[model samples]
Target: MDNENNVNKYSKEEQLNESRVNHDDQKLTTNQGVGVSHTDDSLKAGNRGPTLMEDFHFREKMTHFDHERIPERVVHARGFGAHGHFQPYESMAELTKAKFLQDPSIKTPVFVRFSTVVGSKGSADTVRDVRGFATKFYTEDGNYDLVANNIPVFFIQDAIKFPDIVHSIKPEPHNDMPQASAAHDTFWDFVVNTPEITHMIMWLLSDRAIPRSYRMMEGFGVNTFRFVNGEGKGRFVKFHWKPLLGVHSLVWDEAQKLAGKDPDYHRRDLWDAISKGDYPEYELGIQIIEEEDEFNFDFDVLDPTKIWPEEIVPVKPIGKMTLDRNVDNFFAETEQVAFHPANVVPGIDFTNDPLLQGRLFSYLDTQLIRLGGPNFHEIPINRPLAPIHNNQREGYHRMTIDQGVTSYSPNSLRGNAPHPTPDTEHGYAHYTEKVDGKKVRERSESFNDHYSQASLFWNSMSNAEKEHIIEAFHFEVGAVMDKQIKERVVEMFNHVDGELATEIAKGIGVAPPQNPGGTGVTASSPAVSQENTNQVAATRKVAILLEDGFNHHQVTQVMEALKSAGVHSEIISKNLGMLTGVDGQQLEVNKNYVNTGSIMYDAVYIPGGRQSVDNLLQQGDALHFVNEAFKHGKTIGATNEGVDLLVISQVEGIELAALDSQAELVSKMGIVTIRNAGDMGTIEQEGYFSQQFVSAIAQHRHWKRKNKKEMVPA
Candidate 1:
């Protein structure tokens, strides 16, 4: 009992180490712990003939390697995870009796997994799909998994239609073409047929589909849940995870380019952020409604396809979660960790939302087959901080060692141990709500109005955001071979907005709908727009474009200023190694032209030197780097002779700084440049070049460029 208490309060890191195996200084051996002599060559007849079948070492090695992999998840197969802790602002004893929510001093250890829904395990990280943000909190009561997604709504209202939507989004069966993308014929066909999926389809076509980084996206539990208090009263609630950094996304061109240049863009961003101590943080918010007021809204409170507008029911942020540690091993921890919506503690219970009810049963059933057994909860990543005990035991992969002869409960032979507790104790109690409904399998009548909220989503998008949505629809529906499917899609979205349907019809070669109904509800939720999010320069990566004989004096000042502001800068050149500046000072090149591209970075910067800029003018890759960054709405900065490259790149969106050949600084539309930088700390002075450049980088991207329709060669 003393030893148990010593490790009882173990954090997730300490608990995970109990199952972690270190092979650092150990000798190589077989699975049975037998020392091996050589593994390079297999046993054969006379060293060159057929291998001997009786060779136990060769057979065993080949057999294990062949069967090493288990089944991947049906959805959200490609994922990355990190370890973190959740801290509440204050006790929420009045709202709910949840132990973790009632304590402000205690930090609950957690594991968070981020993923793409349509892709396989081998898919790219920057795909245009829903991103899963599942979190498992190892609290004192038990493991509570808040399964969520980057988007606040879902594609289907009923659970039975889940399999159908997934099948349609997957590659067509006849020819398994278009890996890890939903821009295909079958997907569009399903969207037009499933009228209930209008709201989700609008989101899937918006900028939210392509995220800039996992650290800068919002997460939402896409189902209505119940929060039960100590007095047996229940309140309807929805979970939200608002990122501290802000909700940001990549342009379609940048996203597609990154798929080829850097497939692990989001995963690498998250890993580098934590490794450099720039931890990602998010706040836990809940939108709650009293049980009596549930039926007072225009839309159904239990509908999975609808979102309770922040104006109607404001989100009350009660806690914050910070991710500070990366997983030690990907497969052992991230892959093996199983999350279920059913893993809830006391005071957090389920509701009668049909989609939520179906997930409770589906998640548990899928884990058994995908994880190979029912004992997956024992895996280190999924194990809870609280102790577990039960009477029935001994399933596949069971690790517990039971000494007693008795396995059943309520028996005098084993002193009738492991007694149950009522609601007064720590035992879990399900919320008791009066229910009277027919045995019909039909959906609720209130869940039938789907186009109204879909129109609300369209009405809330910015002009630029609306353009992106129309472009996305053109790309997704124009790929369809069937003319009927493409036309059906155009007509279906006409209910959302007139211009949206007309623009999509023009691009896809279909007739526009005449009378497009724009759901006359003049309400827009500002919370759903990314234009209204927190922005900062911290953790942003910028590529400093340079060549030999660059201006060290000016570049050093910019670098120092950026570093102080928590911005990461990497030197990109034609080749690797040291680059000598005009003043004999050398700068190390972290990335080369062939190894990196503009899509992987947030901004591009160039320092000034006459000879260096002249040399860079000769390289085609350097010119393309500037144009590509400009086309993607990224910030671009240059000083002195470096502005010459910008002019040669033919990007016309910002005013240059100059006065009759005299040195002057200019800042316009996220582009900062100077005719010349004179001395040390000159750019660092207040209201100077460095300040303007860093502030532009903090803007994340220059989305409001003047040349919004200009085409670049790159």
Candidate 2:
């Protein structure tokens, strides 16, 4: 019943360990051929003496260890990847001639890398930044890379400003004060100067940036691209990946705490979910706009800082992808796998989006230095399932040997082999869109309207979401030592919304900007709000606290009911092992007070028993467990003596319905307590209690409930 035992039941860790095949597995001996004993340890002179120069073992280990680390990505250095397959829901022959899209039965192998854009490899995962959700699909024709992010918008419109934005967000050169954080003077100054980043800044400050789990958030190809059909017809398209579990996020405080509690929070969530058969699923959705109707929308399609609102051009769910396997080796598979937007099939093509254009160069350029050569594609994880044939050869780390002396085209000796195939043969043909412009460093006038979409995002958020955004802005801006930078940020964001600027100003102790500007755009997209997302209790963790002499039968029944609804329940007691029930039943303990905290789980449950209640009351930490759960707006259920803890804790206006009294205690309120067994039975049987609990959990916190007691309970 311990975490180790529960983890062993899944065997995911064992499978991961087995997947990592060391060089010793091939039975290859050392150059000396004197069968080696200790591969993990280097040979020492004598009892941890200076490493001997003649020690081949020590030399080999040090040589390999020295080269263990590859160059971290210039951007998105911290990343985690998984293996999956994509299956189209139906054929889309009319839209595109791509074989992968044309065949509904074909399952395309995919490797997806979820990354933090600004952090280094060793940085924390729960930072306020955009998450890179890049997917590489190995189709029959070639690999199609859908390089994307959790946010639909980018920080800038043109690729030229990419380096500038990146430099601003990165740690300052003078002292490198902040690591993996944008809440600094440089970042604010850049934002205030470049208003185009307003929309993405709004998203970065929202809870969406700090996702509860990578499996539960949405991904978007931030730039527009074109889809070419067999007939040469083209349509501008934007890709989206909608998670099956819907979008969920952690409270800012919780996210920060989790960074310390578990730096691998997102990675562990993904591995654990897949290992337990809860495969992460995402549906491939596309927003298609006809070539002729491209100019029909009010916003510019090529602007990377804007979104084609789903309300205007609805996303057509085309395919589904499920990540069923974890990586074999972090360095060989996850780290070596290269993704570039330039990797496209016959049907897929790029647009004139400048940011996308720059990424096309950046991805390939970074791989050459990071992976040590142009032959990175030969890496097992990056290899295309389809056959490869070409005259190009002889790069660093070349693993393949060309048979003949014909490494170039136009050679009769090679029978003109590997010749270029026509477009009809499913060859990659670029879209033939006419373009005529003088070479100049300038932005399109159409891309000038930056504040419109930013305002639209502000208008779309729910009240609770707005509050969180304001708090986020306050926390970030308040961290800046420069007061002028904070004032400038408030003034600049005033264009997005007056209320937003005012709220942020109030929290940061700055004067609200007078007469905040507006873009006169009244558009709003409801899909941007998390409150409208699908809510479920499936896979949500609920902690059940119990002690000796507890009402085991009632607790067991409640736990079973939760499990039947797909809720994960963990029993936590003061000690590990087993606790005896009132009826002499032994209940397994999943966690002890010393090992777990209230922040680890989604909700808390307490069972009614005289001895258990008395024991819990005596333990100060146990009382804190209830208070913290309540502070988080999690549901609390108690029948008999369990209710006593709530009373002793002095919860304000604590109301309990008398057994069989038939009286309601403030309908649809923050807290609920049932006295009668029959009422509890009705609540459980009808699933009303479960629904209420799930709703409370989704709300995340009840800001309405104010704690009145002055004395701090210790």
Candidate 3:
């Protein structure tokens, strides 16, 4: 096994370096390879004269710059991508004949792009929208793209309504006001009219919409696909990618704050994690059912707005994917890599889901315009490892050279070579499902139960999760200036959960909605909630705000422990320069108060020292940092004089411990303190404090402590 693994690794390395040899010793030159002294300026009559047209350098440079940008994606414009490998945990020969899944030893190279659905290319990361989790596998068969999303369900039932749904959620046409947000009149108005979107609206309004990090979020294909075995037997399957770190989210306030504090939070987290060898891992799980049993469920299996409950069909883990490499260039790789749901291998096939069917056309059409013509597949990043042979050739940016008399299929020309392969012999064959129905524009009755699963999702959430959902609804509805739209939306959601609608209405200072009714389906799936997800402290960032005369020894002890535990800790002060510690040790500050804020970090730590506390009090932003951290329910540690700052600021709900006492204060409330810097030895052993902090960070907010009053300065 070791020898085989080494051989495969060597082959991959060789392939990666295959295109690098040409540039090894090449000198800098233009496209013509003419060595020029200067490339920055064009040949002119004089220094301040008009540039001459004879200077091809300037013409070429300006021409390239003029056409540098292509059309951005109509949806999911903001995205981050990484390189990775997909390895099956065991042979899935029983389910499919796809080579990538049939071999446990082979590591198929993959490129994944994570994106936001509605935001443009320049929008902020933390927004209330479905995240696009698309992966392209360069398998020996071809490029297989598992285009998915963070949510399992989509807004529209059919592809025909996709454009309408997108248009409604996008900025209002009259005035593009609200970029990267759905909290507006048009969105709610659409929701009120479109009943099929209720289930997805529940997901969009939940904490799942505001993921803490890309590494911690779950991914779902959102559409049912088919798996065919060698014998032509097929089964319906839904794909799921469960993150090892588990699903987590930020508080609405925290997300809003981070948008300003760190707009590149998710992208930076992914890049930093991969660079540090803390590669993000996700398990590929599939919910499979017999093709004949598709009608056995209460809802239409082909409906994109519905989900298969885990209780009915368990998710079978098939493989694991680790994103271990960051892209070399954002434009060349991340921006140009195209992912289409229709890119399937022989073993995998598509279903007749309206949205999925539309996506099959949309993705290819989008690439043609975005990547320039039909040759996007020829791009290095989108190219497959296997050889591509076809009579279809030539387009804008064509990279391949076909040297044969035959450019078209069929006939005795070229001895009828490059012929099509039969399905029985390693060829893709569509499943022979009988289809005989009258052509009509209508939806299936099974797709009508939009409120049941939405209610199930509501019922599955934990208390904290439910509170966050209510807060999200309040936030979104509060932003709607139209009173009728807000009322209509609340009334529409009342059918999902009367309690939720009433609570949101109260929070937003609106009248409680009248009960429109429910689906009367008393079922809850615990898997739908993030509270039951796996939790770990790995890759969580803790900001240690320090100033001159800080407790160097205590700070170093805590920082070392956190670092050893895989928690990233950075010292933030009022300046980027070094500050003298209490013991005269100079500690380097990574960020200053002007650049960094508590919202950008997972937790906050304030080391004790008289001068440090004085400096914190003197800086207004530093005091607001502590106040904001406290309000957000982040885990905060302050020993000795560090506690003095908290007290001086009169931060609400803080229970400080007496100096010299090791008794932990607010042990179960997410706040931790050792009272003295010398008592740092027991910090890790304080399991109670650890549990509290972890739970607090996981909850992401303490909405119950809603004190409208501002903090008082002592």
Worst 10 residues of 3 by lDDT: 41-50
Estimated TM-score per prediction? 0.89, 0.86, 0.86
Instruction: Identify the runs in model 1 with alpha carbons over 4 angstroms from their true place.
Output: 1-70, 679-685, 706-709
lDDT of candidate model 3 versus the reference: 0.79
**Better model by TM-score: candidate 1 vs candidate 3:** 1
lDDT of each: 0.84, 0.77, 0.79
Q: Write the per-residue lDDT of candidate 1 for residues 199-298, one digit (tens) a residue.
A: 9998988999899999999999999998999988899999999998898999998898898889999999999999999999999999999989988999
Backbone clashes in model 1: 0
lDDT of 3 by residue, 170-236 (tens): 8876567689999887788788888889999889989889998899999999998999888889999
Candidate 2 lDDT over 1-714, as tens digits, reads 699886675453353344354755465356567665544322323321222346465344333332323678778889999999999999888888888887778899999999999888988888888999999999999888999999999998755456567778988765665899998877887888888889999999998999988988899999888888889889999999999878888777767877887788889888887888778889999999998887898788878888998889999999999999999899998888899899999998887776676566556766777788889888888889888999879889988777888888888997898788888898788888665554334556787887889899988987778878998998889987667778988888888887788888998888998886666667789999887776666667778888998887667666776776667789988889999877788988999877777766777777777888898889777787777666555555564667667777645454554545443332133455544342333224444444444455544445455343223232
Q: Worst ten-residue run, lDDT, model 2?
A: 41-50
Cα-lDDT of candidate 1:
0.84
